[model samples]
Target: MSANQLNYSVSNAGAFSDFASVTEGMLKGKIFLKDGLQLTSMEVSLNHLPPKGEVPFYHKHQQNEELYIFLQGQGRIQVDGNEVDVHEGTSIRIAPDGVRALRNTSATQGLHFIVIQAKENSLTQWVETDGIILDQPVEWITRSSCLK
Candidate 1:
């Protein structure tokens, strides 16, 4: 068999406690994945906003576009002065120069979401062209085998 050749990093954000446990900065309730995962191409953050909470400031990026993916609760996001409601399963892509801010509007539930930032107009290939299908056998591993 070929030598195992793979590199990866895994972390549980919950190990740091609930998102709202952070009390020091504008990035409260947020955890950055880039530093922890040593990612080279993009920045990713997991966020949770307490009820009626907000992002604290409106900002724009110089060259990176952002994608926001909402996972729980409800909220609103303002882009370039226009506000739109968002909820679980909502996904939005904002261009580099679009001014943006967000808030959790739910009166009782917290908002959970993820944001991914990457260079604008940098994707030259997608799954169809960028991924290679290996001609290898498909083997299913049983849970019992994992313990051994």
Candidate 2:
């Protein structure tokens, strides 16, 4: 294996002990860096947003695009001033230059989601370079829920 390659790895994303405070009432756990995975330049994280809270400000990535996969609760994501409702299983891919922000709109339900961010125009090589095989069936396995 190449020095940069990471063998198969797993993480229990629900354990919230180690979290970075994004804002008051909002926190995120960086899973990619924590796992030491060099598979992609992507940044992966699980974010928690309290009800009625929102991202502090609209922002845009100059070189990285972002994909948000909502896992629970209800929210609205505004991309370039266009708002769209989001719920469990909702996914949104935003261009690197698109201004974006998220808000937890549910009065009682907190929001939880995964965000994967990576540089624009950098993903195709995963297939061309055989970094990821496209034809194989995906494998699913469970990890212990309590990870310290």
Candidate 3:
């Protein structure tokens, strides 16, 4: 890796180059780079969203902290149970286990947001806070297990 800076203006990654097809990802950019940045230092990558782009099924993480900075188009963000508007210049974050989702709401434009996931094990650790279980089937399974 060369002793290079991550300033996109200086990097050769062409515009509309880092296309992230999936609904959501922790990072989106050229897979290999010369930054050699560390987790403590953190890194940034640009992202793309197709029309009607929606993030992965709502879920939470065990230890990861994430942030989304909207750079283009219009959209909506649902966090925990609150839905809010999103658009260029909107900044959002999901603390460790916060339930959140992003949805593109524009008709003629595609949504784009820069996402950064902080250093985390990325282990989907599941635990019911306040004995809450949203999945009724799973709740039933657990109750049956204890009775058996």
Candidate 4:
């Protein structure tokens, strides 16, 4: 599908240049902003790190907290001097002021991850309170099943 569709956008991480090509102190991923995603409250990026590579510097944000989700390979993330091992399915959340750095520890596999950033303490509602049940039936579900 095209990067920007009806109400959403989709793009692969591989579409962006390698992390090694990113300049120092810059975000090391394909930010959705450049894809015309029209995001207003948060920023998302798809990141890939070469095997045995590491972010050259530790950094922190001033107002945006970050969540890192590891999707492939092995890695280590350091936050405020504490290190944690991460691999596929691993996730870590860091507050705005928490200094953080990452490294790809695998000898032969690249690290694939996603980073989501948003203003801290900005969420006022969660799934239970924010979502409303709709009476409309889903197209994928059989009509007879709705009666059950």
- Leading candidate by TM-score: 1
Q: List the residue pairs that clash in candidate 4.
A: none
Model 4: per-residue Cα lDDT over 8-46, one tens digit each: 765444443365465423645434543456677898777
Candidate 1 lDDT, tens digit per residue, 82-120? 999999999999999999999999999899998999999
Candidate 2, run of 10 with poorest lDDT: 17-26
Candidate 2 vs candidate 4, lDDT winner: 4
Write down the lDDT that model 4 would get.
Answer: 0.79
Each model's lDDT comes to: 0.85, 0.72, 0.62, 0.79
Model 2: per-residue Cα lDDT over 10-127, one tens digit each: 5544433233344322334334443444445677776777778788788899898999999888999999989999999999999999999899898887787888888888867654
How well does model 2 score by local distance difference test?
0.72
Q: Among these predicted structures, which one has the highest lDDT? A: 1
lDDT for model 3 comes to 0.62
Clashes of 3: 0
After superposition, which runs of candidate 4 have C-alpha atoms over 4 Å from their true positions?
A: 1-7, 10-35, 140-148
- Report the error of model 1 at residue 70, Å: 0.4
**Model 3 lDDT, residue 13, Cα:** 37
lDDT of candidate 3 over 57-107, digit per residue (tens):
787767667777888889998888899898989998778768987787876
Candidate 3's C-alpha runs over 4 A off are: 1-12, 17-40, 119-148
lDDT of 1 at 119: 99
